[model samples]
Target chain A: MSSEYDTTETLDVKGQSCPMPIVKTKQAIDGLEAGNVLEVVATDSGSISDIQGWADGTDGVELLEQVEGDDLYTHYVKKTE
Target chain B: MSTDNPTTSVDDADSEVDAAELQALRERVEELEASMAAVDDGDDQQKMTIVATQGSFDMAYPPLILASTAAAFGWEVIVFHTFWGLDILHEEKSQDLKLSAVGNPNMPMPNALAALPGMDAMATKMMQKKIDENGTATIEELIDVSLESGVDLQACQMTIELMEYDEDDFYDGVTTGVGAATAIQHMAESDVQLLV
Candidate 1:
């Protein structure tokens, strides 16, 4: 499913906990240009909801796809504006 | 019969208009109260203040962690350090802050083992190691993050005078050195206050 969208950059925050994943994701997303996709891979189970909720609250970033693989959670966010 | 009398009928009409006006005024007061309540609620939801009074390794983490996390949530966060807590802001003193296993019910080791001569140091090292292994940010790193995220770090002026410490003893990013009165004022205005 990752092959569907073009990813501009990938951030692997595998061992990080709750807010770190969200914080790093926010930082990574901020560094991207408009319309660029950021692929985030995190091991924290909380990231599934955390990233979704963060994207929901954030204005410019859109959560495109979220996939769960065994112990890893992958989120694709595109900078919309 | 009253309706048939012109004077009584005029009086009834006048009373009806007065009642309608009274009802409109009541609704207006209710709307004003609701709007004022909303303004107060907004004021209460945006600011938080935390006071740190301990300098141990375990004690240092809470304020830094909370301040950084709260700032990330777009809150106006202030962390005031007084007494021993001021040690956490000092580069040399911060490294010497140790976790004591003695009398700590939550310590993993039994009392007898924890009472050993070197147990406190051992516990401190073990805890630091575990924190690093968990990829949790160090106190210094969290302090930097909190400052970068706009969490105001303050020192107690009275404590500095009492302890005979100068401003040079503390690291950068301490923007203010204030008295307890100032800290109390901030706490009174803040929506949330925590002492750790």
Candidate 2:
């Protein structure tokens, strides 16, 4: 799926379960500079809410967009200072 | 007459109102200070401490799962292994941790099948396979991930001493051997504390 926002990096966490996807996503986002967009693609069904909740709880990160495709979910997040 | 002092009466009323307002402001300040103090006490909302007391394959997952997940959330996670739970931290014994199907209510089959001679081994293999198929990290992998993410892994000193197990018996990531007091300190500091 296409994201309106330009992503600086894409983290593919496909086939990973609940916490692993979130964990890897967090780690991936941590490496990027502020204002960079991270596109996290995952097959875990729970990643939809998990990523949203993670973004909500975390500071300096904003959920820009979410795209759901067949058996896959992509989360677009922008890191803010 | 006192009624003639109208300005004085007005001033007196104004002063009484001022006094009440001052009291209310003081009370509000005190309440805010109390809450701030509570927050400063390090209720450790961003920290988690888990006590792992069981070593079975079924039992080993909880602490590792929680510790890793908590670390994933950017929380400071600590897992304290005591007694049988230390087996998960042991280099060799960890591989031997087995799931017993005989009395497990969650086992699909009847007790007759579960009671078969080698069923425990079968159940353990099944459990491990299911964990692998589900994309869940193994206990060893979880421990490694947790450590790499800065989760603190501690062994119970009392148990280690009682068991006569050397520190070499545990995996590389086991950071410290601490007594109940240290574990209790972690629990007290953590907002999310679990005994598994």
The best candidate in terms of DockQ: 2
Clashing pairs in 1: none
DockQ, candidate no. 1: 0.27
lDDT string for model 2 (B51-97, tens) is 99999998998788778777767788889999999888888888889
Each model's lDDT comes to: 0.85, 0.85
At residue B33, candidate 2 shows an lDDT of 99
RMSD of 2: 6.2
Q: Which tens-of-lDDT digit does each residue in B1-196 have in candidate 1?
A: 6559898888999999999999999999999999999998686457889999999999998898778767655678989999999888877788778999988999988889999999999999999999878877777777777787788889888888888988888878885569788888989989889999
